[model samples]
Target: MSSLTVLVIDDEPNLVRSIQFSLNDQNIGLHAAYSGNEGIKTFTTLAPDVVLLDLGLPDQSGLDVLAQLKALSPDTPVIMISAHGDTRTAVKAVKEGALDYITKPFDIDELELLIKRCGEQQRLSKELRFLRSKQIHTQRIIGNSHNIQQLREMIEQIGNSAAKTILISGQSGTGKALIARSLHDIRFNDAPFIEINCAALPEQLIEAELFGAERGAYTGSVQKRDGLISLADNGTLFLDEIGEMPLAIQAKLLTFLENRVYRSIGGGKERKANVVVIAATNKDLKEAVDAGAFRADLYYRLNVVPISAPALSDRTSDIALLVNFFSEQFAKQEGCKPPIWSDDVISQLKTYPWPGNIRELKNLVERITILYPGQTAMPKHLPNEYKQNPASSRTEDSNYSSVVENKERELILSALSQCGGRKGLAAEQLGISRHALKRRIQRLHIDL
Candidate 1:
């Protein structure tokens, strides 16, 4: 382990010397400051793991220094040392955010133990933060196509904004939930991220699950329950498959969305929670609204910041990247080497229309990694659906062809506009060679 840094802010030379001598064998990097201002400056520059601050300073009050230190870095542990360490002063120090208060002539051994404890705590806190960051990065949406890039930019915009209601619309398995989680993780990683699937729950119990239930509200309600909304207070609440939410519950949810307040079942008092609601759905909410299956008002409210996650077929250029990423992830999990994709396998993958989208691609990669570790993945290893109808995979669906063509045309035109109508520059912007860009423009019948 690396050495822990401890900053000591005190005007007493003898006491500073004593601390240095006693902790010399503890393998700690000790830094001393004679005044509060100097201590703040040293703390800012060094960013030490722990601070030993004296209550009596030559320049300023220790309480003021303590507050300033916390304002700079709230997580760094601060211990107060003073000669006049009465109960009242200790209480005051702690109330101002001191981790612990020590009196003068304190036992050297006890002080060393306290420093070690603080060092361990700081290490654990840093580890937890690192793990959280890794988790966020692992769960991020992976793609490089124009549609995917636009989706990512929208996510960042909405994540940084104060928009409380966001709706993610996409086909099944296109990673709607993943986008929702990305938005939450970016801004509210330290807060709760509660997800509830409306399609998974029965209509009769969804209201209770979302808004909680009071004691004796129903046959099974023996005690008061905190629902997902209440649990997600000051955090994010992701409602997946929101189109499956019943109409009655839709009204209640709309009310909550309008005014961050709701009441439990069989309870009279109203409760409020500050939650950001991110809803995802595979079904066409507008069609459902027209059919009277969903409320128009609720749909409008949830669609405050709508984001569309592109299907796998719409972003064929990203298939190889996804394949490699999933292969490595599964290989690490299974304790095996990742499989290499041959040219034939890559070509075959890009041609197939992934109806199951990214979920299907991930599953296929995991299966290949587990069955043929350290081997080259080829077309023969792919499923029969991919091999038998490789050429006709996309042609079979007329609606899909039209959608893909429109998206392709739009992407090409946007690239051309961005590059000032220069074919070579547009090709580079779109991650393709000039010849390929010319072929696409000709095929799409795009005007210059």
Candidate 2:
């Protein structure tokens, strides 16, 4: 194991020197503090891997110190150092926050073992956080369209700013979550990225899951647990589908967003977490607020830096690029060579309005790669839904127009007729901006 940085808080110079001497062979960096205040100052600065806090301190009780340290960085492991007669207090320290305790007349070997255990556990957790980031790394936002370029610039600008709370608004499958991860990678790459879907968790349990709960706070509560906010200290906490969050929880969330302070369920000491909150939602928050389903105050608080994830139809030009990327990705994932995509298939894909966006596009590529590994993939091999949508057999009539132009006309008319000639609703179903739909209508010379 790598050397562990340990902060020892005790008044005994002789005992401190003894520990330093005994752990000399371990190559550890030891910081000594003879009093509680000194220990806190050093802890706030050092952020050592593990702490050996004395249960009895000269200036104040150690339990109070433990609570402060926990509020600052809950993930940091701490062990209690107590005298033989203070054994009961040591165990209570464990309940308070300490990972383990060693009564004085402590064996040096046992102390070394405890330190190593803490180091190993922390090493594992770091690895897990790295793996989570790695998974996001593989799913890069791939596109070169104007909207994508603007979105990229926005991420860089917002990431560089001091804004702590951001609201990501977009339709489902439009890569709102991807945009959130991109923002996280920009600023908090080294720190943990904790996320929770507010809509996925049960209404009864959402509060506890996000803010945590004290022991016996709920029916199944067995032990005190830290919330995602605490876990994401000095990092990013992604609240997905935030519009679906309950009204009561929205008020509590607003309090935390404003001050970076929160209280757990069953209410313990108010804890502070330095976390950048990135909230994503598919719902129209303004509409939801007006409808009395979402809190207005919370909505405004979270919208400090609003980000919109563009739908696929807004960047139809990038579909070919995305198709190539996904095909190569899924082919490698399936342990097979990527199938050759015909130009006809690419053209057909570009013509069809992708309502499900990139996610749907990715699924299509993955499915095709699995079924036809090395063969040439054509429009014929594609799903009938893809072929039947806009590119009907009538595109060949010379009196009509070019295949691409005819296809666009048909798609717009189909969407328009289905929505009873409502262009706004049709534009939504087509996954394009209202302006894009308007431009298409003018270009296609379609009658109302």
Best by TM-score: 1
Ten contiguous residues with the weakest lDDT in model 1: 130-139
Q: Write the per-residue lDDT of candidate 1 for residues 212-233, one digit (tens) a residue.
A: 9999999989999989999999
- Per residue, candidate 2 scores C-alpha lDDT tens digits across 244-285 of 899989988999988999999997689999999999998999
Off by over 4 Å in 2: 1-139, 391-448
Clashing pairs in model 1, backbone N/Cα/C closer than 3 A: none
Q: Candidates' lDDT values, in order?
A: 0.82, 0.81
